[model samples]
Target chain A: MTSSFTRLLVMVQKELLELVRSLKLLWVPLVFVLLGVMQPASMYYMPLILEKAGNITEGAVIEIPQPLGSEVLAQTLQQFGTLGLLVLVLVGMSSVSGERNSGAASLILVKPIAVFSFTASKWTALLLLAWGSLSAGYLASWYYTGLLFGDVQASKVLGSLLVFGLWLSFAMTLTLFFSTLLRSSAAAAFSTLGTAAALSLLAGLLPKKLGWLPGSLSSFAYQTAVSDIANVSLFGWALACTFTLMAAALTGASWLLRRSSAID
Target chain B: MYDNFDFGQILPIIAPILTIQLVLVIIALVMCIKAEQTRGPKWMWVLIILFVNLIGPITFFIFGRRNER
Candidate 1:
């Protein structure tokens, strides 16, 4: 067991080194920070933008109400949900399948490392990237929102970050699972994004029935940030479902990779 | 409200966003140039990254490269 743990750690280190070398460690989070700041900055300057771009006649009145800080933060999370999730999925889509397709996995698998450790390492690296980028983006949004709007409770900010991070985790895990199962990275990305979109749509259309679904994690995060009162029970269930799904996906990827490695 | 378009006040607020965006575009451009190969024409990616705002550079970054190792 100790040996396995050490193996996992060594694999994770290798994965992190690869991430840094590829410059994903830098660019992904930078993209997230940009997305995060855009929400609040655009919101704060919407009227000005409209005036300048729309060429509204002087004395023409525009009455867009200023959004609350929490709402601004929530909107930032929304940005992360869509474009941010897409970027992460694209970055991670090739995690396993790319290696296998390029014959890199065969080289590594011939070594003494366990397949579980390999999958676990990839999953951990992806998680670190996802969580790090999300947190940085969320914190930037919170800071800008506070500066431009009003103060939001730090507790609420942290709570929303936790929930939204879980949603991103599920997306990344789905990408990883598909990468392991499929030989083509593009197919893996497309399928994962499609599944995420469908799940999000279902959760949106049937909020009451699908409130506990992993897709609703984003909504839960939004509500937690924007409202003083949130449905804790639903949030709890969503959290539970997300973690369970993530675990299942990780194990499934390991199993699939083991079979693929054996075949190779 | 029209008078409130003070560049001094606005620049401070909007500067960080523009800077971040510029950095992203620059990074994407540098990568595109240095990349051994990309998915589409190199000129097309340069145009997209230069003109298409946030999503363009990101698209180029995520999907542009054929070989990312």
Candidate 2:
């Protein structure tokens, strides 16, 4: 047991080192930070932008009200949900298939490490990147929102960050699962993204029945950010579902990779 | 229109975005030049890394590299 744990650790370190060497560790967070920053900055300048673009009468005035701090932060969360999610999925799309294509997976599978540990290590490394990038981007956005739009409660920010990070983890686990299942990285990325979008859409379309789905975590996160009172029970259920889904995806990936490594 | 738009406040707010973009461009360019095999011609990637703003570097990172593990 101890040896397996150590193997997992070593694999995690290797995965993280690859991330660092590829410059993903640097650029992904920067891109997310840019996404985060754009929200409040663009919202702050919306009136000016409208004034510059819109053809108005001489005496017309732009009466758009400034967004509240919480709203700006929520907008940042939405940005993270879309473009940030895309960046993360793209970054991790090649984690398994790329190694397989390069014959690295075959070489690594010959070692004493268990396939579960191998997949777990990849999940761990990607989770670290996802959570780290999310925190950096959210905090930077929080700072800018505070700077430009006043301050949101720290508790709200922390709560929403945790909830949103779970949503991202759910999406990333799906990416890893697809990466292991499919040979083509583009197909893996597309399927993972399509699944996530469809799930979110379904949850949106039927909120009452599908409230416990992992996709609801995004809405729970938004509520945690902007609303004073959130549905605690719903959030708990969504959290539990997301955790289950992530665990299932990881196990499935490990199983698939274990069976297919020899073929690859 | 003679207006009271202060560039000073906006400068501090917007500078980081510009700086991050510049840094990404530079880093992507350097990596492209150093990489032994990229998906396309080196000169094309150099042009993309130089011309496109935020997306150029990211595209190069994702699709441009060959045999990245």
Candidate 3:
């Protein structure tokens, strides 16, 4: 058991090194920070931007009520839900399948490392990146929101971050699972994004019925930020479902990878 | 519209966005220069990373590299 733990640690280290070498560790979080900052900044400056770009007649009033700080932060999460999710999926889509397709997996699998360790390590590294980027972005958004608008409660910000981070973990885990199952990275990315879109769409369409779905985590995060969550039971269910799905996906990826490694 | 707005107030707010963008572009350029195998022509990626605003560097980071080695 100690040896296995050490192996897992080694695998995680290798994954982190690769991420750094590829500059993903630097760029992904930076992108998130940019996305986070842009939301509140643009919203704060909307009037000025519109005045400059729209070329309205002088003295033409464009009186738009300022959004609450929490609402602005919620909007930032919305941006993260869409474009931020896409970037993460794209970055992680090639985690396993790319190595396999390029024959790197065969090289590594011929050694003594366990396949479960390999998959678990990849999952861990991806989680680190996802959580790190999400936190940086969320914190930036919170700071900017406070600066530009008004103070949001620390509990609300932290609560929303945890909820949204779980949703992102679900997305990243799905990408990893698909990457292990499929040979093509593009297919893995497309399928993962498609599934996320469908899940969110379904939850949005039938919030009363599908509130427990993992897709509703984004909504939960947004609502938690803007005000008190409307349904505590539903949020709890969604949290449970997200954790279950993430674990299931990781396990599925490990099994698939073990089979594939054996075949190779 | 132009006279009433305080440049001092606005610059501080927008400065971080521009700084982050500049950092992204610089990092992308450095990586592009150092990368041995890009998905397409290196010169074209340089163009994209330089000209495409916020998305260009992200695009290069995601799709431009072959991800080998």
The deviation in Å at residue B12 for candidate 1 is: 1.1
**Local accuracy of candidate 1 as per-residue lDDT tens digits, A1-264:** 999999899999999998897778888998899889888988888887898898788878989998899999998999999989989999999999888877889899999999999998999999999999999999988899999899999999998898889889899999999999988899999999999998898888998889888998888888889884367777778778888998998899998888767554
> Candidate 2 clashing pairs?
none
Docking class of 2: medium
Considering DockQ, which of the candidate structures 1 and 2 is the better prediction for this target?
A: 1
Question: DockQ, per-model, please?
Answer: 0.65, 0.63, 0.71
TM-score for all models, in order of appearance: 0.94, 0.97, 0.97
The TM-score obtained by chain A of candidate 2 when compared with the true chain A? 0.97
Model 2 earns a TM-score of 0.97
Sort by lDDT, top down from the best: 3, 2, 1
Candidate 1 pairs with clashing backbones: none
Best by lDDT: 3
Error of 1 at B61 (Å): 2.2
User: Cα RMSD (Å) per model?
Assistant: 1.9, 1.5, 1.4
